[model samples]
Target: MPIDPERARLLFQVISSCYERRSLILTTNIEFSKWGTILGDEKLAAATIDRIVHHGRLVEFGGESKRMGDSLMLGRQ
Candidate 1:
Protein backbone atom coordinates (compact mmCIF):
# COMPACT_ATOMS: atom_id res chain seq x y z
CA MET A 1 0.00 0.00 0.00
CA PRO A 2 1.27 3.42 -0.96
CA ILE A 3 1.47 6.08 1.71
CA ASP A 4 -0.58 9.25 1.31
CA PRO A 5 1.44 12.25 0.17
CA GLU A 6 0.45 14.34 3.17
CA ARG A 7 1.37 11.57 5.56
CA ALA A 8 4.64 11.02 3.81
CA ARG A 9 5.47 14.66 4.14
CA LEU A 10 4.54 14.58 7.78
CA LEU A 11 6.79 11.57 8.23
CA PHE A 12 9.64 13.47 6.62
CA GLN A 13 9.02 16.43 8.86
CA VAL A 14 9.05 14.22 11.90
CA ILE A 15 12.26 12.55 10.87
CA SER A 16 13.90 15.84 10.08
CA SER A 17 12.99 17.29 13.43
CA CYS A 18 14.20 14.23 15.24
CA TYR A 19 17.37 13.71 13.27
CA GLU A 20 20.33 13.35 15.64
CA ARG A 21 18.17 14.81 18.41
CA ARG A 22 16.23 11.72 19.35
CA SER A 23 16.54 8.02 18.84
CA LEU A 24 14.14 6.28 16.49
CA ILE A 25 13.60 2.57 16.25
CA LEU A 26 11.95 1.53 13.02
CA THR A 27 10.97 -1.99 12.10
CA THR A 28 10.02 -2.81 8.53
CA ASN A 29 10.00 -5.90 6.39
CA ILE A 30 10.59 -3.84 3.24
CA GLU A 31 14.18 -3.12 2.28
CA PHE A 32 15.57 0.41 2.02
CA SER A 33 15.68 0.24 -1.78
CA LYS A 34 11.91 -0.38 -1.90
CA TRP A 35 11.02 2.38 0.59
CA GLY A 36 10.41 4.79 -2.27
CA THR A 37 7.61 2.58 -3.57
CA ILE A 38 6.00 2.46 -0.16
CA LEU A 39 6.51 6.17 0.58
CA GLY A 40 5.34 7.15 -2.94
CA ASP A 41 8.33 9.45 -3.44
CA GLU A 42 11.91 8.55 -4.10
CA LYS A 43 13.31 11.75 -2.62
CA LEU A 44 11.32 11.43 0.56
CA ALA A 45 12.29 7.80 0.96
CA ALA A 46 15.92 8.53 0.31
CA ALA A 47 15.99 11.39 2.79
CA THR A 48 14.26 9.34 5.40
CA ILE A 49 16.62 6.43 4.87
CA ASP A 50 19.66 8.69 4.94
CA ARG A 51 18.71 10.15 8.31
CA ILE A 52 17.79 6.73 9.72
CA VAL A 53 20.93 4.92 8.62
CA HIS A 54 23.33 7.73 9.38
CA HIS A 55 23.08 7.15 13.12
CA GLY A 56 21.38 3.81 13.38
CA ARG A 57 22.17 0.15 13.76
CA LEU A 58 20.31 -2.31 11.58
CA VAL A 59 19.32 -5.68 13.01
CA GLU A 60 17.88 -8.14 10.54
CA PHE A 61 15.97 -11.31 11.33
CA GLY A 62 16.02 -14.22 8.92
CA GLY A 63 13.43 -16.83 9.79
CA GLU A 64 9.75 -17.57 9.66
CA SER A 65 7.67 -14.88 11.31
CA LYS A 66 6.69 -15.47 14.93
CA ARG A 67 3.42 -13.65 14.30
CA MET A 68 2.61 -16.05 11.45
CA GLY A 69 3.29 -19.03 13.66
CA ASP A 70 1.06 -17.61 16.39
CA SER A 71 -1.73 -17.05 13.89
CA LEU A 72 -1.48 -20.64 12.65
CA MET A 73 -1.67 -21.91 16.21
CA LEU A 74 -4.74 -19.79 16.86
CA GLY A 75 -6.39 -21.17 13.74
CA ARG A 76 -5.71 -24.70 14.89
CA GLN A 77 -7.27 -23.99 18.29
Candidate 2:
Protein backbone atom coordinates (compact mmCIF):
# COMPACT_ATOMS: atom_id res chain seq x y z
CA MET A 1 0.00 0.00 0.00
CA PRO A 2 2.86 2.32 -0.78
CA ILE A 3 1.70 5.79 -1.78
CA ASP A 4 3.39 9.00 -2.82
CA PRO A 5 3.68 11.63 -0.10
CA GLU A 6 1.48 14.12 -1.90
CA ARG A 7 -1.17 11.46 -2.34
CA ALA A 8 -0.88 10.58 1.31
CA ARG A 9 -1.22 14.24 2.25
CA LEU A 10 -4.23 14.63 0.02
CA LEU A 11 -5.74 11.52 1.56
CA PHE A 12 -5.16 12.98 5.02
CA GLN A 13 -6.80 16.22 3.95
CA VAL A 14 -9.80 14.34 2.60
CA ILE A 15 -10.09 12.36 5.81
CA SER A 16 -9.75 15.53 7.90
CA SER A 17 -12.53 17.15 5.93
CA CYS A 18 -14.63 14.05 6.40
CA TYR A 19 -13.99 14.18 10.13
CA GLU A 20 -15.05 17.83 10.15
CA ARG A 21 -18.31 17.08 8.31
CA ARG A 22 -18.91 13.43 9.22
CA SER A 23 -17.14 10.37 10.60
CA LEU A 24 -14.16 8.54 9.16
CA ILE A 25 -11.92 5.67 10.11
CA LEU A 26 -8.48 4.55 8.90
CA THR A 27 -6.25 1.51 9.21
CA THR A 28 -2.60 1.36 8.19
CA ASN A 29 -0.35 -1.60 7.45
CA ILE A 30 2.83 0.16 8.60
CA GLU A 31 4.16 2.82 10.94
CA PHE A 32 4.35 6.52 10.08
CA SER A 33 8.10 6.63 9.34
CA LYS A 34 7.71 3.59 7.19
CA TRP A 35 4.95 5.46 5.44
CA GLY A 36 7.40 8.27 4.74
CA THR A 37 9.84 5.81 3.26
CA ILE A 38 7.08 4.39 1.12
CA LEU A 39 6.11 7.88 0.00
CA GLY A 40 9.70 8.87 -1.00
CA ASP A 41 9.04 12.57 -0.40
CA GLU A 42 10.24 14.22 2.77
CA LYS A 43 8.27 17.46 3.07
CA LEU A 44 4.93 16.09 2.04
CA ALA A 45 5.48 12.98 4.15
CA ALA A 46 6.25 15.15 7.19
CA ALA A 47 3.12 17.19 6.63
CA THR A 48 1.04 14.10 6.14
CA ILE A 49 2.44 12.61 9.32
CA ASP A 50 1.57 15.78 11.21
CA ARG A 51 -1.99 15.83 9.94
CA ILE A 52 -2.47 12.15 10.82
CA VAL A 53 -1.43 12.83 14.44
CA HIS A 54 -2.91 16.23 15.20
CA HIS A 55 -6.07 15.91 17.30
CA GLY A 56 -6.07 12.18 16.62
CA ARG A 57 -6.44 9.19 18.91
CA LEU A 58 -3.95 6.46 18.03
CA VAL A 59 -3.39 2.93 19.23
CA GLU A 60 -0.44 1.02 17.79
CA PHE A 61 0.19 -2.70 17.77
CA GLY A 62 1.68 -5.44 15.63
CA GLY A 63 0.24 -8.77 14.61
CA GLU A 64 2.16 -11.83 13.48
CA SER A 65 1.56 -12.79 9.89
CA LYS A 66 -0.63 -15.83 9.73
CA ARG A 67 -0.13 -16.22 5.99
CA MET A 68 3.36 -17.50 6.58
CA GLY A 69 4.15 -21.03 7.65
CA ASP A 70 3.00 -20.78 11.22
CA SER A 71 1.99 -23.70 13.37
CA LEU A 72 -1.20 -22.13 14.69
CA MET A 73 -4.35 -22.67 12.67
CA LEU A 74 -5.88 -19.40 13.91
CA GLY A 75 -9.20 -21.12 14.57
CA ARG A 76 -9.22 -22.62 11.05
CA GLN A 77 -9.92 -19.31 9.42
Candidate 3:
Protein backbone atom coordinates (compact mmCIF):
# COMPACT_ATOMS: atom_id res chain seq x y z
CA MET A 1 0.00 0.00 0.00
CA PRO A 2 1.17 3.49 -0.81
CA ILE A 3 1.75 6.00 1.98
CA ASP A 4 -0.44 9.05 2.24
CA PRO A 5 1.18 12.05 0.51
CA GLU A 6 0.57 14.56 3.28
CA ARG A 7 1.78 12.12 5.92
CA ALA A 8 4.81 11.27 3.87
CA ARG A 9 5.69 14.94 3.49
CA LEU A 10 5.22 15.50 7.17
CA LEU A 11 7.44 12.55 8.00
CA PHE A 12 10.04 13.82 5.52
CA GLN A 13 10.08 17.26 7.09
CA VAL A 14 10.29 15.82 10.61
CA ILE A 15 13.21 13.59 9.67
CA SER A 16 14.99 16.44 7.92
CA SER A 17 14.52 18.70 10.91
CA CYS A 18 15.84 16.07 13.30
CA TYR A 19 18.71 14.87 11.14
CA GLU A 20 21.99 13.95 12.91
CA ARG A 21 21.17 15.92 16.04
CA ARG A 22 18.91 13.14 17.28
CA SER A 23 18.61 9.40 16.95
CA LEU A 24 15.91 7.74 14.91
CA ILE A 25 15.11 4.12 14.24
CA LEU A 26 12.80 3.35 11.35
CA THR A 27 11.78 -0.14 10.40
CA THR A 28 10.09 -0.50 7.04
CA ASN A 29 9.62 -3.19 4.43
CA ILE A 30 10.01 -0.60 1.68
CA GLU A 31 13.45 -0.13 0.17
CA PHE A 32 15.06 3.27 -0.13
CA SER A 33 14.83 3.03 -3.91
CA LYS A 34 11.05 2.66 -3.67
CA TRP A 35 10.61 5.48 -1.15
CA GLY A 36 9.80 7.87 -4.00
CA THR A 37 6.84 5.72 -4.93
CA ILE A 38 5.68 5.71 -1.31
CA LEU A 39 6.38 9.37 -0.64
CA GLY A 40 4.99 10.48 -4.02
CA ASP A 41 8.13 12.44 -4.88
CA GLU A 42 11.42 11.02 -6.09
CA LYS A 43 13.34 14.11 -5.04
CA LEU A 44 11.96 13.97 -1.52
CA ALA A 45 12.67 10.26 -1.35
CA ALA A 46 16.26 10.68 -2.43
CA ALA A 47 16.87 13.48 0.02
CA THR A 48 15.24 11.53 2.85
CA ILE A 49 17.28 8.46 2.00
CA ASP A 50 20.47 10.50 1.87
CA ARG A 51 19.86 11.84 5.35
CA ILE A 52 18.96 8.43 6.78
CA VAL A 53 21.76 6.45 5.12
CA HIS A 54 24.37 9.01 6.04
CA HIS A 55 23.90 8.31 9.74
CA GLY A 56 22.03 5.03 10.01
CA ARG A 57 23.15 1.47 9.55
CA LEU A 58 21.19 -0.62 7.09
CA VAL A 59 20.20 -4.01 8.46
CA GLU A 60 18.17 -6.25 6.20
CA PHE A 61 16.56 -9.51 7.22
CA GLY A 62 15.54 -11.85 4.45
CA GLY A 63 12.91 -14.47 5.18
CA GLU A 64 9.20 -15.06 5.36
CA SER A 65 7.13 -12.73 7.46
CA LYS A 66 6.63 -13.68 11.12
CA ARG A 67 3.02 -12.61 10.86
CA MET A 68 2.55 -15.00 7.97
CA GLY A 69 4.00 -17.82 10.01
CA ASP A 70 1.70 -17.05 12.91
CA SER A 71 -1.32 -16.86 10.64
CA LEU A 72 -0.48 -20.24 9.10
CA MET A 73 -0.10 -21.84 12.50
CA LEU A 74 -3.43 -20.39 13.63
CA GLY A 75 -5.17 -21.63 10.53
CA ARG A 76 -3.84 -25.16 11.08
CA GLN A 77 -5.05 -25.11 14.68
Candidate 4:
Protein backbone atom coordinates (compact mmCIF):
# COMPACT_ATOMS: atom_id res chain seq x y z
CA MET A 1 0.00 0.00 0.00
CA PRO A 2 1.14 3.51 -0.76
CA ILE A 3 1.92 5.80 2.13
CA ASP A 4 -0.57 8.54 2.93
CA PRO A 5 0.46 11.89 1.49
CA GLU A 6 0.49 13.75 4.78
CA ARG A 7 2.37 10.97 6.51
CA ALA A 8 4.84 10.85 3.63
CA ARG A 9 5.44 14.54 4.06
CA LEU A 10 5.91 14.11 7.77
CA LEU A 11 8.35 11.29 7.15
CA PHE A 12 10.29 13.47 4.76
CA GLN A 13 10.36 16.24 7.32
CA VAL A 14 11.69 13.88 9.96
CA ILE A 15 14.37 12.52 7.68
CA SER A 16 15.33 15.95 6.51
CA SER A 17 15.58 17.25 10.03
CA CYS A 18 17.74 14.34 11.04
CA TYR A 19 19.94 14.40 7.98
CA GLU A 20 23.65 14.68 8.80
CA ARG A 21 22.83 15.65 12.39
CA ARG A 22 21.84 12.27 13.79
CA SER A 23 22.47 8.64 13.07
CA LEU A 24 19.58 6.60 11.74
CA ILE A 25 19.08 2.93 11.19
CA LEU A 26 16.25 1.96 8.89
CA THR A 27 15.35 -1.58 7.95
CA THR A 28 13.01 -2.32 5.08
CA ASN A 29 12.35 -5.27 2.85
CA ILE A 30 11.34 -2.97 -0.01
CA GLU A 31 13.89 -2.08 -2.65
CA PHE A 32 15.06 1.51 -3.19
CA SER A 33 13.52 1.68 -6.68
CA LYS A 34 10.07 1.02 -5.22
CA TRP A 35 10.38 3.81 -2.65
CA GLY A 36 8.61 6.27 -4.94
CA THR A 37 5.58 4.01 -5.12
CA ILE A 38 5.75 3.34 -1.40
CA LEU A 39 6.10 7.00 -0.45
CA GLY A 40 3.66 8.02 -3.19
CA ASP A 41 6.04 10.77 -4.30
CA GLU A 42 9.03 10.32 -6.52
CA LYS A 43 10.73 13.53 -5.48
CA LEU A 44 10.21 12.86 -1.81
CA ALA A 45 11.52 9.35 -2.19
CA ALA A 46 14.56 10.51 -4.10
CA ALA A 47 15.37 13.15 -1.53
CA THR A 48 14.93 10.72 1.30
CA ILE A 49 17.12 8.13 -0.39
CA ASP A 50 19.78 10.66 -1.25
CA ARG A 51 20.19 11.77 2.36
CA ILE A 52 20.08 8.21 3.69
CA VAL A 53 22.60 6.68 1.30
CA HIS A 54 24.97 9.63 1.40
CA HIS A 55 26.40 8.53 4.77
CA GLY A 56 24.82 5.14 5.16
CA ARG A 57 26.23 1.66 5.03
CA LEU A 58 24.07 -0.99 3.40
CA VAL A 59 24.11 -4.47 4.90
CA GLU A 60 22.23 -7.14 3.00
CA PHE A 61 21.33 -10.55 4.33
CA GLY A 62 20.75 -13.72 2.32
CA GLY A 63 18.83 -16.86 3.24
CA GLU A 64 15.35 -18.02 4.14
CA SER A 65 13.16 -15.81 6.27
CA LYS A 66 13.43 -16.49 10.00
CA ARG A 67 9.67 -16.05 10.35
CA MET A 68 8.98 -18.99 8.04
CA GLY A 69 11.13 -21.26 10.13
CA ASP A 70 9.14 -20.43 13.23
CA SER A 71 5.71 -20.48 11.53
CA LEU A 72 3.05 -22.83 12.91
CA MET A 73 2.10 -24.09 9.42
CA LEU A 74 5.58 -24.85 8.24
CA GLY A 75 5.13 -28.64 7.94
CA ARG A 76 1.36 -28.84 7.57
CA GLN A 77 1.42 -30.12 4.02
Candidate 5:
Protein backbone atom coordinates (compact mmCIF):
# COMPACT_ATOMS: atom_id res chain seq x y z
CA MET A 1 0.00 0.00 0.00
CA PRO A 2 1.10 3.53 -0.70
CA ILE A 3 1.87 5.82 2.20
CA ASP A 4 0.06 9.08 2.85
CA PRO A 5 2.21 11.91 1.55
CA GLU A 6 0.77 14.50 3.89
CA ARG A 7 1.22 12.29 6.90
CA ALA A 8 4.73 11.41 5.81
CA ARG A 9 5.61 15.08 5.43
CA LEU A 10 4.30 15.96 8.85
CA LEU A 11 5.99 12.98 10.48
CA PHE A 12 9.36 13.93 9.01
CA GLN A 13 8.87 17.52 10.08
CA VAL A 14 8.18 16.47 13.64
CA ILE A 15 11.13 14.13 13.71
CA SER A 16 13.39 16.88 12.35
CA SER A 17 12.31 19.29 15.06
CA CYS A 18 13.07 16.72 17.72
CA TYR A 19 16.66 16.39 16.63
CA GLU A 20 18.89 16.65 19.69
CA ARG A 21 16.08 18.42 21.55
CA ARG A 22 14.61 15.27 23.11
CA SER A 23 14.56 11.53 23.05
CA LEU A 24 12.32 9.53 20.76
CA ILE A 25 11.01 6.14 21.69
CA LEU A 26 9.35 4.08 19.02
CA THR A 27 8.20 0.49 19.27
CA THR A 28 7.55 -1.48 16.12
CA ASN A 29 7.62 -4.99 14.75
CA ILE A 30 8.95 -3.59 11.46
CA GLU A 31 12.68 -3.90 11.06
CA PHE A 32 14.80 -0.97 9.92
CA SER A 33 15.87 -2.83 6.80
CA LYS A 34 12.28 -3.06 5.61
CA TRP A 35 11.35 0.54 6.38
CA GLY A 36 11.29 1.51 2.73
CA THR A 37 8.65 -1.10 2.06
CA ILE A 38 6.49 0.25 4.86
CA LEU A 39 7.08 3.94 4.14
CA GLY A 40 6.60 3.50 0.40
CA ASP A 41 9.37 5.95 -0.38
CA GLU A 42 13.02 5.16 -0.40
CA LYS A 43 14.15 8.74 0.06
CA LEU A 44 11.75 9.34 2.91
CA ALA A 45 12.72 6.11 4.58
CA ALA A 46 16.42 6.89 4.27
CA ALA A 47 15.98 10.39 5.61
CA THR A 48 13.86 9.16 8.46
CA ILE A 49 16.44 6.57 9.37
CA ASP A 50 19.24 9.11 9.10
CA ARG A 51 17.56 11.59 11.42
CA ILE A 52 16.60 9.03 14.02
CA VAL A 53 19.81 7.00 14.01
CA HIS A 54 22.31 9.85 14.09
CA HIS A 55 22.92 9.80 17.84
CA GLY A 56 20.44 7.09 18.53
CA ARG A 57 20.85 3.95 20.53
CA LEU A 58 19.47 0.70 19.23
CA VAL A 59 18.21 -1.93 21.62
CA GLU A 60 16.57 -5.17 20.54
CA PHE A 61 14.55 -7.65 22.55
CA GLY A 62 13.55 -11.09 21.39
CA GLY A 63 11.20 -13.67 22.91
CA GLU A 64 7.85 -15.35 22.52
CA SER A 65 4.86 -13.32 23.70
CA LYS A 66 4.52 -13.48 27.48
CA ARG A 67 0.80 -12.85 27.33
CA MET A 68 0.31 -15.73 24.93
CA GLY A 69 2.44 -18.01 27.05
CA ASP A 70 0.54 -17.08 30.20
CA SER A 71 -2.80 -17.69 28.52
CA LEU A 72 -1.74 -21.11 27.29
CA MET A 73 -0.32 -22.12 30.66
CA LEU A 74 -3.48 -21.02 32.46
CA GLY A 75 -5.60 -22.98 30.05
CA ARG A 76 -3.59 -26.10 30.83
CA GLN A 77 -3.87 -25.52 34.59
Candidate 6:
Protein backbone atom coordinates (compact mmCIF):
# COMPACT_ATOMS: atom_id res chain seq x y z
CA MET A 1 0.00 0.00 0.00
CA PRO A 2 1.15 3.47 -0.82
CA ILE A 3 1.47 6.06 1.91
CA ASP A 4 0.97 9.75 1.48
CA PRO A 5 3.50 11.11 3.88
CA GLU A 6 2.20 14.67 3.64
CA ARG A 7 -1.31 13.63 4.59
CA ALA A 8 0.03 11.58 7.45
CA ARG A 9 1.96 14.55 8.74
CA LEU A 10 -1.04 16.83 8.42
CA LEU A 11 -3.30 14.37 10.16
CA PHE A 12 -0.77 13.93 12.90
CA GLN A 13 -0.64 17.70 13.30
CA VAL A 14 -4.40 17.89 13.48
CA ILE A 15 -4.55 15.14 16.10
CA SER A 16 -1.82 16.74 18.19
CA SER A 17 -3.52 20.10 18.02
CA CYS A 18 -6.88 18.65 18.98
CA TYR A 19 -5.30 16.79 21.90
CA GLU A 20 -3.23 19.69 23.17
CA ARG A 21 -5.87 20.91 25.61
CA ARG A 22 -8.53 18.25 25.60
CA SER A 23 -9.09 14.63 26.47
CA LEU A 24 -8.58 12.00 23.82
CA ILE A 25 -8.57 8.23 23.67
CA LEU A 26 -7.17 5.93 21.05
CA THR A 27 -7.42 2.16 20.86
CA THR A 28 -5.30 0.20 18.50
CA ASN A 29 -4.81 -3.51 17.92
CA ILE A 30 -1.55 -2.79 16.22
CA GLU A 31 1.42 -2.63 18.54
CA PHE A 32 3.91 0.23 18.61
CA SER A 33 6.81 -1.46 16.87
CA LYS A 34 4.67 -1.97 13.76
CA TRP A 35 3.54 1.65 13.54
CA GLY A 36 6.41 2.95 11.48
CA THR A 37 5.94 0.17 8.98
CA ILE A 38 2.19 0.67 8.87
CA LEU A 39 2.85 4.36 8.31
CA GLY A 40 5.29 3.57 5.51
CA ASP A 41 7.03 6.89 5.99
CA GLU A 42 9.92 7.02 8.36
CA LYS A 43 9.98 10.74 9.09
CA LEU A 44 6.24 11.22 9.42
CA ALA A 45 5.94 8.06 11.48
CA ALA A 46 8.69 9.20 13.79
CA ALA A 47 7.02 12.55 14.24
CA THR A 48 3.68 10.96 14.88
CA ILE A 49 5.14 8.54 17.39
CA ASP A 50 6.90 11.38 19.15
CA ARG A 51 3.69 13.36 19.44
CA ILE A 52 1.68 10.37 20.65
CA VAL A 53 4.26 9.18 23.18
CA HIS A 54 4.63 12.72 24.50
CA HIS A 55 0.89 13.11 24.92
CA GLY A 56 -0.19 9.62 25.94
CA ARG A 57 0.39 6.88 28.43
CA LEU A 58 0.99 3.25 27.54
CA VAL A 59 -0.56 0.48 29.55
CA GLU A 60 -0.83 -3.26 29.26
CA PHE A 61 -4.42 -4.11 28.48
CA GLY A 62 -5.16 -7.78 29.05
CA GLY A 63 -6.65 -10.55 26.96
CA GLU A 64 -9.73 -9.97 24.87
CA SER A 65 -13.14 -11.34 25.69
CA LYS A 66 -15.45 -12.03 22.78
CA ARG A 67 -18.62 -10.57 24.21
CA MET A 68 -20.31 -8.57 26.92
CA GLY A 69 -21.67 -11.84 28.22
CA ASP A 70 -18.17 -13.23 28.45
CA SER A 71 -17.09 -10.13 30.31
CA LEU A 72 -19.81 -10.64 32.88
CA MET A 73 -18.71 -14.21 33.41
CA LEU A 74 -15.10 -13.14 33.73
CA GLY A 75 -16.07 -10.47 36.27
CA ARG A 76 -17.49 -13.19 38.52
CA GLN A 77 -14.33 -15.31 38.27
lDDT of 3: 0.87
Clashing pairs in 6: none
Q: 75 in model 2: Cα distance from truth in Å?
A: 11
Instruction: Point out the higher-scoring one by TM-score: 3 or 5.
Output: 3
- On TM-score, the leading prediction is 4
Which model scores highest in lDDT?
A: 4
CA deviation > 4 Å runs, candidate 2? 4-9, 16-23, 62-77
User: Per-residue lDDT tens digits of candidate 1, residues 1-77?
Assistant: 88899999998999889999998888888999999999999999999999999988999998977787778667931
> Would you give me the overall lDDT of model 1?
0.90
Q: What TM-score goes with each of the models?
A: 0.85, 0.56, 0.81, 0.91, 0.79, 0.61
If both were scored by TM-score, which would come out higher, candidate 1 or candidate 2? 1
Residue 52 alpha-carbon offset, candidate 6, angstroms? 1.2
For 1-77, candidate 2 gives per-residue lDDT tens digits of 67765686677678657654665566877777776677777666676667567757787765776664454555444
Global lDDT scores for all candidate models = 0.90, 0.67, 0.87, 0.91, 0.81, 0.70
Query: Which is superior by TM-score, 2 or 4?
Result: 4
After superposing candidate 4 on the true structure, give the runs of residues whose Cα lies further than 4 Å from its correct spot.
Answer: none
Clashing pairs in 4: none
State the displacement of the C-alpha of residue 39, model 3, in Å, after optimal TM-score superposition.
0.6
By TM-score, is 1 or 3 better?
1
Model 4 over residues 1-70: C-alpha lDDT tens digits?
A: 8989999999889989999999888899999999999999999999999999999999999897888877
Model 2, position 4: C-alpha lDDT score: 69
| Evaluation by lDDT, superior candidate among 5 and 6 | 5
Question: What does each candidate score in C-alpha RMSD?
Answer: 2.1, 4.4, 2.1, 1.8, 2.7, 5.3
Error of 1 at 53 (Å): 0.3
lDDT (10s digit) by residue, model 3, range 26-49:
999887788898888899899999
Best-to-worst order by TM-score is 4, 1, 3, 5, 6, 2
